[model samples]
Target: MMDLLRSLLFVLLFYPGTLLYVLTVIIVSPIGDAPVQAVVHAWSQFHHWLVRNVLGIRIVWDGAIPDGPFLIAVKHQSMMEAVDTLHFAQCPVVVMKRELTVIPLFGWVTRRYGVIGVDREAGASALRTMMAEARAAVSGGRPVIIFPEGTRVPYGTSPPLRPGFAGLYRALGLPVVPVAHDVGRLWHRGFVKRSGTVHFKVGDVIPPGLKRDDVESRVHAAINALTP
Candidate 1:
């Protein structure tokens, strides 16, 4: 009963807060990237407040976050970590699906942040485009994050990575940092956001120039390090 009330409150607060933040972004967009980042940071901080005050959830980071100019391959179990990535990374740019670029306010902010989008069905051309954006983002001193599985897997499930991750690694020629976390049990894909600490464990940074298979295996193992 109490949990239900908290969930309701969280949902009620989230939409309005999101709208307010999006409006703020629009107003500040002309100021350039610093203001945009400030707004994004504030938005992330707002969600943190909601998680702790409304839902009684806390975040526990396990290791040192990488600096930048690197590729991050993360385990995708829920939306919680995706937002958390915004908090953990320094000057981060994410590799996301092209469809997300059309998502109204959210997509507007994504584009504002210079996120790289890929059309998976476009084959070689898509890879070329993704690589170009990724290269530019890295050259500009931002870490690139990609969810290896490409989509959220339910708790306790470990799926094989999508093909694009490896391609990005090879094309970008940056160190790959793997992040592991188990947040699905609490903040699931559904509506409920349970209370607890979500641990984000950072694994070793795999240097660039390795074979595709070698890189994939290393990243897969590193991301699942804390899974059991």
Candidate 2:
């Protein structure tokens, strides 16, 4: 009923909104990366507004966003949070699968945005390549955001993180900021975006140099600590 209408409205509006932002990106691309990112940030902001006003969805941030260059290991539940990161992070270099880079305009602009794309099936060599790119991104003083689970997990379920997360942590030697959120409840992995507040709870910064097992255990617990 209403859910279907809201969902349909969300889908209809999204196409135009994305097109508008893509046009902005094209117009500002000649100016440089910073301006282009500003355009993307504006789009994310608009998305937030649409979610709040049109879809009756709200986003609440419950913890501090770390300062300086670091790695952000996020709980991947929905695309909403991914869009939100464009606004939340100072300047983020997202580590994504190589497949996403072929997504028409999204792929083209994200490459221009300097996102690191990796072929996940490539094994150790891919890990090395990912770390190298992430290192370069952080070197520029921007944060790197990675989905620990490597893909979206359904709401209320926690999955073991992929090895790449630990690999990057060890290779980069930077504090890992674990960000947890229950966005799946609202912006589902399927469709049917529900109406409610999505809470982004940032946990304590996990210091670098921990053993792989320790790092994974700590981050896994910290991210899933959010209640209500």
Candidate 3:
């Protein structure tokens, strides 16, 4: 009963809080990227506050959060980690699905804020576009983050990475930093979120230019290291 009430309160505050931030982003986007980024940073902080206080959850980091221009491949278990990334990284350019970039006002702000959107069904063309944008982002010294698994999965499952991860890895030529976390254990797709600690374990850096199979194998294992 307490969990249900907390979840309901979070949902009640979440939507309005998100809307306020999104509108702020939209308004400030016309000024410059810096202003937009500040808004996003604030938004991420807001989420952290809610997750910690309202939902009674805590985030525990086991390793150093990677800095500089590296390809960050993360384990995707729930939406919690997605928002958490913004709080963890400074100006990370996240690669998301094209569908997300097509949303109404929210999508506009995401594009303005520099999210790389990929059309998964567009075959090679999508890969090319994603690679190009990723290169530009790296040149600007921003980290590129992607969920190698492509979409969220239930806890305790280790799925093979989507093919696009390999292509992006080859194109970016940046060392890969794999991040494993246990958010899905408490935060599922539904509204009732349980209270517990979400552990984020960052793996060692995987050097670039390895054979596709070798790199993929290492990343797959690293990102699932904490999964049970």
Candidate 4:
């Protein structure tokens, strides 16, 4: 089928393209953050091009992308939004699992690029470290993005957020911006991606200093507003 062929081509092109981009990042990393950031932007743009032309998918933004530093809690449905975040935000500090930050060359590049890796199994220690890094990122005027649900879930399913979200919320004391999207409908955890529009709906900003239960409930609801 056309979808299968397109998917195959996409994989073939994406991996090699990513390798080149990674290498570029590694090379420019020593120069300064600006050069590295430029490479990352180009890489994200490349992904957008492939998704639109090769996979026949379109990304539709429903609301304005935030410009200032804030805690961005996004709904994680698939890898599409993971990469797309680079395109939507201006020099965002993404919080990802420590495992991802340990990958060979990619890991080093990620650390150099300012990604905050979270050790999920490290319990309270991990939260402390993540909060520390998030504070630094916010002070630098870069938005910190995290998947509140911790991991990707199937379409139409909304899970409770991980505990670290509230801890980070309290520590950073920054307003939270919830982003809702339906990427799994066309780009689930497999090959042969379907062609359609992936809607990215940005919810209103939630101010800081609310009760843990209240903030969690509001973010959970906002991020899943477009789920069903």
Residues 1-228 of candidate 1 have per-residue lDDT tens digits of: 676788899999987998899889889999899999888878877887888899888778788876767888889887667766777688688887788877888889888978888787898898889889998888888889899888888878888888889989998898988999888778786776788777878998899999989999999999987677
Model 3: residue 127 alpha-carbon error in angstroms: 1.1
Cα lDDT tens digits, model 2, 1-228, are: 676788889888987989888877988899998898888788888887778887888778888887788888888888787777776678788888889878888788778888888888899998999999998888888899998888878889888989999999999998989988888887886668788787888999999999999999999987777633
- The segments of candidate 2 whose C-alpha lies over 4 angstroms from its true place after superposition are none
TM-scores, all candidates, are: 0.94, 0.94, 0.97, 0.97
- Candidate 3 lDDT over 1-228, as tens digits, reads 888998999999987999999999988877988999999888888988999999999888889876777899999988788887886677999998899898998888889889999998999899899999999998998999999998899999999998889999998899999999989999999889998888999999999999999999999999998899
The candidate with the higher TM-score, 2 or 3, is 3
Q: Poorest 10 consecutive residues of model 1 by lDDT?
A: 79-88
Task: Give each model's whole-structure lDDT.
Answer: 0.84, 0.84, 0.90, 0.90
Give the C-alpha miss distance for residue 49 in model 2, angstroms: 1.5
TM-score of 4: 0.97
Q: How far does residue 50 in candidate 4 sit from its true spot (Å)? A: 0.9
Q: Write the per-residue lDDT of candidate 4 for residues 1-228, one digit (tens) a residue.
A: 898999999999998999999999988888999999899889888988999999999888888767887899999988888888876788999998899899998888788889999998999999999999999999998999999999889999998999999999999998999999998999888877998888888999999999999999999999999988
